[model samples]
Target chain A: MNNNPYYGPEGHGPYEMIDIGDLLLEDGGTIPNCKLAVATHGALNAAKDNAILVPTWYSGTSKIMEQVYIGAGRALDPAKYFIIVVNQIGSGLSTSPHNTGGAMTGPNFPKVRIGDDVRAQHRLLTENFGLKSLALVVGGSMGAQQTYEWAVRYPDFVKRAAPIAGTAKNTEHDFLFAETLNEAITTDPGFREGRYGSPADVAAGLKRQAKLWTVMGWSTDFFRANRHKALGFESVQAFIDTFMTGYFAPMDPNNLLSMAWKWQRGDVSRNAGGDLAAALGRIKAKTFVMPISHDMFFPPADCEAEQRLIPGSEFRPLASIDGHLGLFGTDPQMLAQLDANLSELLATRVN
Target chain B: MNNNPYYGPEGHGPYEMIDIGDLLLEDGGTIPNCKLAVATHGALNAAKDNAILVPTWYSGTSKIMEQVYIGAGRALDPAKYFIIVVNQIGSGLSTSPHNTGGAMTGPNFPKVRIGDDVRAQHRLLTENFGLKSLALVVGGSMGAQQTYEWAVRYPDFVKRAAPIAGTAKNTEHDFLFAETLNEAITTDPGFREGRYGSPADVAAGLKRQAKLWTVMGWSTDFFRANRHKALGFESVQAFIDTFMTGYFAPMDPNNLLSMAWKWQRGDVSRNAGGDLAAALGRIKAKTFVMPISHDMFFPPADCEAEQRLIPGSEFRPLASIDGHLGLFGTDPQMLAQLDANLSELLATRVN
Candidate 1:
């Protein structure tokens, strides 16, 4: 295993670029050359037998997942296990619509699904690292959707899986939030059919999208406790200004819109014959379904419901007031519980 | 007392209009020529000692209060008590900047407070109705603010007071919500500095203001459970369109902006030396403070805190999930509770 740093300041990451030379499509059309990024870490010497797969969330890159990698005592600890993290398509750090050799730029990007993301990751693992997944696949939120897809798409590859803070099916309320954000972006006058436009104008739409997030991302109790102090202004205007100023301070407006669109179209069961129950049942991996208790978007109820549908799946719930952001907040008690359970699972090697 | 229906469609009920010719102000100015609509039900002669003063909430009129008066077994049941409902100034049905013989319009209107509202009600009771004392002053929400102000300003004129779902002083959160709504109105280009360039344009601003209310007026759970059916639209866009259509259909934009401005400036103790606790302590009326448990704007904690400061005051929290709307939703149960307590107090009237 190499300890070389993956991500450099500007662009270079865990996944090295690979050129897919021009090929003939199924429709008898010539397809342009494309390059994909593939990143691998941990014990590749043991081949696929010691590998664990990690998929990226919306706008996240494989390098971002490096934060979760550990040398020992952690879920993705490299001391005893190999961890493979992949950047999903459409993410700027990977093979995205923005940099697809003029084929999928702007509004021309093809709609991709969780299955497509898992399929691409599987190819990278098998073709580049010579890994046939043997250990576990773990992810949270949208990443969890990819994890679930991996279990179903390659049942023989994944021995165990942990999908946290995600649902097999998106609820109506989830659709509303996602759709609203999508509209806020696309409806901007400068969107120009998703083509060239002022990045600053696009930033305004992103700010509006972020405002909805600031409201829904936290629990009501959290907002009630810290709104005035957090924003440093008494009125809602202050809250809006503070939120917009902080969220867009470090991110590109185009990148924000791209990620928001991906989130809006995210639906695991959309391609699973619209039968989430059947899809979960097909997962041969021993699954640990853990959900954050107070997650406004994907609550414990969703995971509990999924657990009941998947045979032999263990259900664990992490209690935190941080809502969907609990995975990022890393509550001590929640992390300890997760660490203990994951360590025991890996130690026992029950497959 | 005479029974005459004041405003609204003719012959609906009894309403009496009181004209206050002129009141000299301490600041060497004349108070706006004021007219009030008073609605009375039941025999004031038989239950003259049992008469209760009920003030309307912001934007509410005598017509709306009539529902509370006639509600079965309510605190102001016309069958047993003489209920005198007074419309607060600035409401369209009463003396307002909109219809004060064109005296004060748009930006020319004076900033009025709860004390001013209570004072006007006091004049109507004393000079027009020939009443020296009220058995009780009952109100909810903004109406409750006026009721509390009456107790502080005219302690000797009121015996007992019930202020529901209201705070003795506005909290920062309350100001934030009100300020946001006001900004949503005034910032709209159509507002044109309180005077719209076009009536239709002003109406659009009102519709936008109302949209914010529709969202904040209810709890998140309520919207999630009812948005589909209540909005009568399948898609999110359709739902928002339906909502905006209904909201803007009947409201005058100017009226909405003016009312929101009034609400923004609604500080009951603004004149009380800026000391909220001291202002509350000045109230001499025996007070029954009932804040709705789930009222987001005026939570039970606010009323409970105020109750601790007021002498001879009792806190009775209305346990309901309707939030600020609990003033109307807390029907039979709230009515029964108030009746049981007020009946006991009325039976032992001091006069």
Candidate 2:
């Protein structure tokens, strides 16, 4: 199998890969030689308790996340606290369907879960960094799932958690959205049952996937008010075409499906014997659930529901008209709000 | 070139056809020998003032509308009023991309608009039915677009209007959803730029379209609550396969695109010099704007925004967790509420 350039470690500057080697997943599947792509900002304090963990979201690499959210005085300040952004499996940089050396590539890639990602991240921090616990763990969307998993599974290891534009338990709406993306990729003629000549061969399916994302990703104001103009685009079609093509054109379809399945099946409740409240109750970390106001997928109501289940957890709505995509710091006002909220949470004393 | 069975008028029960030939459209295109399919119930009063006009929705025939909302003791009863269900252009029953004769069929079909449909319906009621005005004009989705157009374009002709699960002006969210559907059809390999041998050949594209509809057409609760089991389907896929295949498999892709474009372009403000509030001010009818509460496409909030602009209009929320497709009267409770709302609106003494 040829390496797809879109996801390999070629251009991932400031990003480093660590060889964990032969990791067992939550689903009982094992990768022969597991590797994780990660990035770090800031410096670990002498006490080693100043590390923050930031998980990469779906369709995003650590480099992209660092660019969008991290800065000197931002919520994730490089100088204030050490922030480690770990790329999840199925993202080609890590041990994904595309980069696996031997027989486990494409459809042969074993199913991985959010729990598995947290487990690997835990090992990376404990064994590699010698960190006993994280000061805080925060992320948006799929990254949020990992945040919740980290808080719940290793309750003592994460002092605080922030899940933005996502939920601990995947909602029915998100499950279906993930399923639709899977269908778009699989039904493409170039898919050929997960054995394609190149990622570009399934361009039609990727285009369809992009179209679906365009509808679900943004709010009414995003298009009606011509907000794409704010992004320096002349029209909605132009922005969508450029963004979708740029994002999905070079990605391997199988890797996408693998991640999508994991996203759909995300639920911390299963770890607590199918009890959502119980799972939430076990999260001893100081929690903050942040949902975008106009998000069509994860509405404020849904986020608040999850937040209410977590005792003493704060619920803050990210006021933005960009819907689910608002968390990308597209609007400066929202980015400021995000930073303020995160700073406040980080500064909160642990009782 | 080949006759497809789903659209032909072989079994259009109670439905009739009329020729309003050679019509000019709002988009400056003309449909030669333009035809409209219609169905009527109840007798026309001697004064012709008891006529209630119902326009069919996107991808809908008069039969489907009748099945969904029309019956004895239902919201739209033919016995108490002369109910006229007019199938809009672009539906196969009318002068659509599929049914147009000779070279005019398929891709050659002219672009039609909501304004063009309102104009044709005005002519059909005036010339064919000898009706000077309508007691009430009611519809859902695209049919709702026509209802608004009728009220705005010919205020004197419509006394009351009921637009359920829809809005007078399409929102950006709905526009994007419409675009997604159009993309699904055109991207189908069988489309062949609208010159396909048969509708069934593009089964892959149709499946993708069906998947999208499955995601957007219903509420998350509709699936999470296993509502499909109530419809006798053991699984979600079973219901989607049975429903979508049964609905769109036999459809001509061009016919869908024609109606989708019309639905997307629906805007009453264009008549009032692009002023929405001013256009709504022209509505002399007692308007009842009903939007489904959980509808992802046309949320109650969005509907209420438009409803607030109409003079003395009542904004009623259809409290359903079933999202956009709730208007079909799928659940009996919602249907009862719909019937009661319409009954109350019909009984209202118009100021």
Candidate 3:
């Protein structure tokens, strides 16, 4: 119903909303009348063992996950597994900062953590769907953070897990990078401390944020090799103006800030009193710690460090010059590699 | 003198100025009342063969170059050679946007290029010092850009050249990165299109820029290893607030923008009718193209590609986790390696 095309049923296609009521956030905030936006494909079996959960990433929704990852013949085959793509809490499709009413609207929205997203989604699967265990839990970036949280928080619930292009614990470097993005929005005079009448009011800040992404989101070689031309960008500036801006502009700024705050503090270690290895040790699910080569956000080294802590987890790297943004499925080669790896993981036997 | 502590003779030590009025810039604009801030050490031998030129990098002055690189018995030994550190145009100590008054002051300052800085320094050395040739022309980062320009533009003038942690032609990625820095300054409401009352007026924008530097300026390992603690910062935020902000806050925004514009378009290729290989091949000096191992700004690959085109030039990679900021001389180990390589480069006979 909002002007933002990327929000609501208009952008996300047909989806169901589950009102989870008042949800207590990990950061001591509350999301009153909290609802989960979910899109499902295929069918659940009598035992519900065929169910697979795929969470949305930052600035992404269930529709993008379905389009880019889920398919009839792909590793995330809807024909075999009942796929559920759940929009995270602050994503505009859900009961988010933009969509919420009264005191908890826009900049006044309560801070929700990654744990909060997991708990909300946990309710949807258990209470609404009557699902006891999931066949696999796969996600990329912020979605991957949720996938890791799911495996660690509720070990027996997730049989298999693949967290792609993400780390279990966000690095200090990434926290600072997110701060730049936040400052880029809040510093705009028109933003008025996020009370802007329209998203366009903070256009300068949003554009500046997009410029920072030009350097960090993609591998240096991607720009060096002129890969933007392959994506139909005549030049880098065209890529920035047309592609990056187009992707971010339609989304609500408050929704992005909410997601970014959660992304910056993404850590499963809190579940085990800040002992990352101890937290990861609790995971019984067969895990594939998939990191994209040249990913600046969560580099292979960062992901591999956490992967080593997860007992029996494989450190799989996807090759893409798109870096952390390889999750967007820009490079067909990287997607194909990801599909092959996921297929192998899904086929493996797990308790 | 300006209130900015980083500006004027107070911050840069006692330096001499040579007025070379109305210098025409490479971009067809002219720097009215052009002056070069210079500091010298040792004496130019009767033959003037022991003279070395060390140009200032971006946000750098002659004093910094002296304190970090030059010493009594170091590779840049002032006692053994006549060392001239010429502060680049737009660098505050020289005639810059902050210090210059009238029509071409502040944001109205003319566009400068790497070629303009080289030309200005060339005038200082040739006209004022009566130098026939230089023993060596060496610099790091933006200073490296000028070093490359000096070697390419005045082949016979520089006998030996070392361009460290920089490319001859700026990359598309770097151009966009510079744009982000520029926008960080301009987007602030207090900036008022570069008519800000003081540098403090753009504090928010500059702090945002410092956050961007926190991600890109240093290597990922530097943060992962908690190297900030070694530098007396208890936390990353403390390092950013205390060190990064303190470094940039004292400087004028317009001066940064002016230098950044020059840095973004740093192309010696323009000299050879847009043929980078041809331009680099024009270097007659014994060249050493050195890149820091983890320098995201100008990666080793970028520098090596250009170095390969320069005949007789060695591609030397300095090991440093400080990355692009290795030019700041933070790591003693990196400084030692740099000093050793420079010593060898200076000792080699070049006719």
Candidate 4:
């Protein structure tokens, strides 16, 4: 794909960058020479209404998303809809601690909020595409946070919203888990104020982080049932290497920490005078809150609560032992269900 | 408290030790002149059948258990029965990596099993106290593993058994969680292959481990309800520092790793020719299996499954949102229920 080791080749389409310059952050710090890495598929029609926006999740790149979810027969079919996968700020492919220029790179990068991402994406749509509104805004995990933010922050822009395996307001357990991830990185002896060279410097912490993911990202059934074997892994270590450790090893620790902090502090409530109910009330988009049944990070009950607050919002709990990783459609049956749900949402008319 | 950093001084009556020289570990390694640290309260009656055994849990010593659960009006009332709290092999208070001699000290300590603990404890009961049997064998977490092992390995030796907030055999999730804990230490750059000069060398890893515990050891409600404030901490950081990081800071990383390995590999089924049902069927005690409702590590369902297999076992799931830490009776009401349950189990008649 790109020179960045954090990204894999073949999953994402052609990469493009847009510079906004010297973007301000939530914590008063700034990321200079602001750039966003984006990928696109299918041509935008003259009507422009067929454009669908997809945001990437934690440690996820646009290409991986394309590889997993985009296809002719998939819910996110590139043939039917103009698909745009935007990499988040801290993701190494975009303006990140690893790629960004200036003193604010690495640990010095300010804490960016979910709100910032929504705002930046809005600019990209308005200025680059000159699109008035999106047919759909869909995402999973932290990407779900952005989807919810889009619906609430610019409700008129997102006609339909699908947030999977994540919540509008992160649960305390999620916050604590994110904190652990960040701590695992920052506390590594080789972290050295986030100025360390090479991923090997923090290999131990990255391994530890991957191990934690083995427990949280998937349910007990994922291991006991040897689901990794189904994914073509010879053993659990192979699975970890293929997905967990290998995925994170090349990542910049500072960027990971930055993203984790944003994930933990994600609160749409802050926009509605610290009222979560009011925040959900502002969302005009046709919302479908989809949560994986066994997702430890974002339980169905948490997602259900948000869906209940939004008028006409649907609550879909995906019963998958794959847990949070179900966001990737680990089961083809799950992908079918997602296709059906998306088709239903896209076909429905709402004023 | 025998001046051990792993223990508190006020609650435990007195500390003692027993030499079981040249102890053979489950992994076929030996610790020369092995000594087991123990604490005792009340009196061993003339019949020597009035003794209650309590094995220490992970990162816990006898005095700490005394500080938390033992008292005049407590379920673990010293005056009612002779209670012997035996620290596990790798517990710093016992013959651990921190105190063992020669090659067995530090990272060189051999892997020990729940079976090995039961064997050593049996020797202590027979050779020192002249006790033919224990009136009750009760424990929590890793301690619970030993409790279950006691009921199965020497079923006739334990008249009554209560294993709380833990499972007889580690589940896939539990194994992953244990592996994560060990990896947190082993991957620490300061660990220097587990031959670090001081605790500071492993402070970063231990902090990361503590952070993980904060997420998994407690439930979502525990943090959302701000129960840490009930325990006198003002903030989550304060709570994590006081109850988590501080609690683990003094521990030897090698000992923690050894115990974690033992915990992950604990499967009584091996004794029954790899049949879990057969192993549980061997439990002849009047067993009361208590699992915390919200324990992510050891779900109540897993504990229920084990209870169903053991004949004459009473399945009692503790209704608490405190997760695994409820074993220390985090809430007063939870403790009251535990007291009532223990009293009921102790008073019941069995074959």
Candidate 5:
């Protein structure tokens, strides 16, 4: 994974990292010398109650979130509250297959679950930062999965939660979709059972993977309206050739496979003997279950079904033709609505 | 495709083939020694005007159409009308990559067009059957593309038409989706630039393609409602392993790539200097543009846009949780509705 130039020192911006020692995984394996890649804004105030925890989504790092969602006067203003964006376990910037050493590197990397990432984040807050509870727990996609994990597993610690464009339990349709993503990478004989010498070895597979993402990552209306042009792409093929491939070109294939595995098994329902309603009923936090109207990955209908189960939770749908990727701040109107909602949710006092 | 057991001499029941001789392709290539596989039901009346034509869809042969859509009491009853089911070029039963010999075999197969299939079928009807005009022309998906081409290119020959679950002009979304399918096969190292020794060599690629199809082939509600159980599969994985993989395991990779290329370029608007409305207006046939309500491949809205342009056409949407695969006769209610629609369509008068 380190052989890839995209995630190397020259490609990505610098971020803080702290070794959390040996981290036990949910799948009965251990990630030795596990480290959490971190980025912070503002200060944790004297009361330490103004800290907002944001976790990275699939293939996402802390940097993009800070740039897109956080700003001076925005709901996540640095001057008003301390915000921590922690990269997920398998994300390239964190303790992933590419950066780990010895047996824990590459294909030998152990399977990490959503619960494991939440547990690590909990440790980071309590042990290192001396924080007792979070002002808010929010994320998009897989980060949303982690948001739900935090709310359900440690309900008391979370004051307010917003899981955007994701489901508490991954649907069978999504599980199968992730399977295709995994297969697209592994089927490239260049993959060689995840033991390929470098990222270039699996270029064909990664390209295929990127193409697959284009099929479902955005809404049908997005393509029908030629929305790619707004993104500075002259043609759909140009957008696919430049943007889609460029996005996946930098990541480690094995790290992606690991993240997909965790994404397929995202089920907070496991906390209540596979009862989704019972599990969501445990959330004491003020919750806003946000779903993108055009998101095929986690449709608003699916998100609303779970929201109905969570007591006093609001089902807030962000209308955008960008689909699940609306969370990337693609639509200015959607971003504005998101900021307004967050502001209102934050202002409301939590018990 | 002949090398694969699924379409081998013993595997497939039986079908008739007619040599169309060397056919010039729309792309300026020639399909030397071209032959089309055909299956027929019922007998032509002495008047010879009670004839109907049906073209095969992407990866479909004439046999499945006869089994699923035609029966003694169905709209396509053999006793009432002479039914001709012509397999499209590149489909395994037709002059596909595996079946052809000499330079045209395998990867050397020339690019085919929907117009080419329509032209070949026209020749077969006029030359072999001695027919003046068809009573109706009906098909699903890619077959529907050919159906549209036939109605527009040879407007006088088709008296009535039904293009089900397809659009006259392939949208950018569908074009991009088809690209992913093509890449899935070509990216496999075992594919070896379409020179794989046998089907087994490209098993990984075909499996990936099959998985990609499942992502959009069936609607979200189909999976969410556990519709696969009615198909006799216990779980989604079981359905994918046996049904999805089995569907593509025996086909030639090059053959699929050829068909996908043709499917992506389906555009009847080319007949009218890229004016879609003018091209559709050329259709004199009494037409019913049928789209499956849940079809993600060719959504109802896309179909309706084209349907509105065709003069004296009805926009008919088939309600099914099965999505585009509703054409497979998966839902009994949907099948009954299809039969009813076809019956009404065939009974309509044409000038």
Candidate 6:
């Protein structure tokens, strides 16, 4: 690992900061200058032969991903593997609408596809670290989408890949949820067409959106078990009050809108010449597709459909009631399954 | 059997009207004095000793309740029982904000409770049809709440009661949903604080409320299965278009808001001494509490909790994903179960 001190807080870590201005698309496009913050662990000098790539999900950062790097009996144990986690572009902590240097901010931020995120991360790996190929690539949800993109966009770079709780193509149901969230944000008069509006207007819209999400993203059984503890107040008003004061209370309305817009346009097929099946078929990586059965956003059927397109791709369905949240909540079980399957594939890496 | 024209269409056809000036609570109250649209099937002359009283859910009427009266070889049947379907007060077809005397239009309409609804139905049964007591009281959803009220408020008048997909007390979750719908309506600028506004404003608010209901009142599995067939449009806009057009395509905004308000304030114990359990225990009628297992609004757990309080009360959970709608979804298995249970209960009824 590089003993770089300037990458993060003083005396904090060994992660490096890499600027990828060389990978920008021309015309001062909104997606240009996709500078990234990268972190490496285990053995960085063996990048070409021993490197594993990890991409962050929405709102995730290198610091958060580092937690999975060095734990005992963990999937990515530092004692056994070299892990490189790259922060995705537009994830606020990285190159995002908030700090795009007069480029894309507010409503002018251009739409970004999953390809753009992976392409930028790829450039950071090859150009900065001299990593020509990866031993493995693993991610969950949007992270999974990026992992799939790495296999498709740079087939020779990835030997084995795991995509958890996600699909190769965005479904119509996914679009509907994204649209509803966007409508909740943009329709609020306080949004001022994605510009200036009252803080109260922004808060109200955020609270409303959060409430919708809490209902759809959680199991009714979970709610029945945890409602009283989660919200100490016994009345419905108290529940709303607790939700507004706790979860949506601190989030910026503009940030919420921007993130929702990004999520809505998240599809690798959008960049794959509009043929999702053909794109999945091109992935040469030994792929493992893990789907959560009760996921409200992306059901296991979506993953099964995608698996059918990728020859030899292994599909695993998790029978957890955590829904989409199982990707995070039950990570230990998922990681165990992933490690057992990928160990054999990694041992057979061509590089 | 009383062959009175007042018992069927001859009594209250789709277009038939009868003056209700004397039934007005008070001049200039929120509720207007409107016609009582009464419709009965089975035997009217024997109604005093054998009538089965049925009420309607929100946005429903006597026309809708008439279908349930033909209870598939169950407790309620035209061949064996007299059925009197009463249009709940405040429903547009009955005394309501829309057509009460000119004094009770729009915002002027007073909020009515389940007790008020039962009282109005009682007056219609005894004064108009000369009925002294009902052999059974039956209803579903909000109508079921009225059925429960019939047993508590007029204990001696109702011999048997069937409350389907309902509970003795509304939970915080139930109120949370109702409150959200109310906020959706009141927040629409066009709602004009429940006064006159643009047709578009009223329509938008009503549509928003309906959308929320569609999400909460059905399981995610149901949406996954039927969203396409129900909406016909593949995109989100198409779904919204179909939903808005179909929801208020034939209804008045004032009537919709008024009925929603009634549902929001629905509480069997609101005026029954603030103790729903005690009120339920006081019910003299033999009660059957039927709840739909997958109902997100009034879940079976709520009804099961209530069953513990009522002596001799039986609890049956309907295993349907129809949520609050299992009352209309004719599952033959559910009907057969209902038949066996009710046959035993009705055989014990005394005139």
Can you list each candidate's DockQ? Answer: 0.14, 0.53, 0.80, 0.56, 0.72, 0.19
TM-score of chain A of 5: 0.97
**lDDT tens string, model 3, B1-351?**
234566777777789988977789877878876898889998999988999999888788888899899998799997899999999999987888888887877888888889998888888899899999999999998989999999999999999999989889999998887778888888877898988989899998898778777788997788998888998999998999999988898788988998898899899999999999999999999998899998888989888989999999998899998989878888999999888999999989988
Return the number of clashes found in candidate 1: 7
Q: TM-score (chain B) for model 4?
A: 0.95
C-alpha root-mean-square deviation, candidate 3: 1.6
- List runs of model 3 lying over 4 Å from the truth: A1-3, B1-5
RMSD of each: 7.1, 2.7, 1.6, 3.1, 2.1, 7.1
How is the predicted docking of candidate 6 categorized under the CAPRI scheme?
incorrect
Q: Candidate 6 lDDT, tens digit per residue, A1-351?
A: 111122244422445657787444322354655667677777765435778888876544566567643345666766667788876665544555545546366556666667777777777777887888888898777788888788877887888888877767666557666565555556566777755533365666667666665555544443555543443556435655674345554444555555555565666665578888778888888887888766767778777878888767778776655567554443456456656655656666453
Q: All candidates' lDDT scores?
A: 0.63, 0.84, 0.88, 0.82, 0.88, 0.65
Instruction: Give per-residue CA lDDT, model 2, range A43-126, as digits (tens).
Output: 999999889999877777888788889888787888889999899998877778887756787888999999998889998999
Candidate 3 chain A lowest-lDDT run of ten: A1-10
Clashing pairs in 4: A11-A63, A12-A63
Report the C-alpha displacement of residue A117, candidate 6, in angstroms: 2.2
Where does candidate 1 stray beyond 4 Å? Answer: A1-104, A107-131, A134-166, A178-196, A202-211, A227-244, A249-258, A261-350, B1-31, B34-70, B84-216, B223-245, B261-351
Error of 4 at B268 (Å): 1.4
The digit string of per-residue lDDT tens for model 6 on B86-105 reads 77766666766555445556
In candidate 6, chain A reaches a TM of 0.82
Candidate 1, fnat value?
A: 0.03
- Cα lDDT for residue B344, model 2? 89
lDDT of 1 by residue, B1-351 (tens): 111122344622467777865654322445556777778877566535667888887555677678654555665667777788887766656655555435466455565666667777887777777787888888877788888788877877888888887766766556556654555456555667866544456554455445545444544343445544643667545545675445443443444455555555555466587777777777777888888765656767768878898888878776654457545543456556656665655554453
> Considering only N, C-alpha and C atoms within 3 Å, which residue pairs clash in candidate 3?
none
Interface RMSD to the true structure, each candidate: 5.0, 2.4, 1.1, 2.1, 1.2, 3.3
- Order by DockQ, highest first: 3, 5, 4, 2, 6, 1
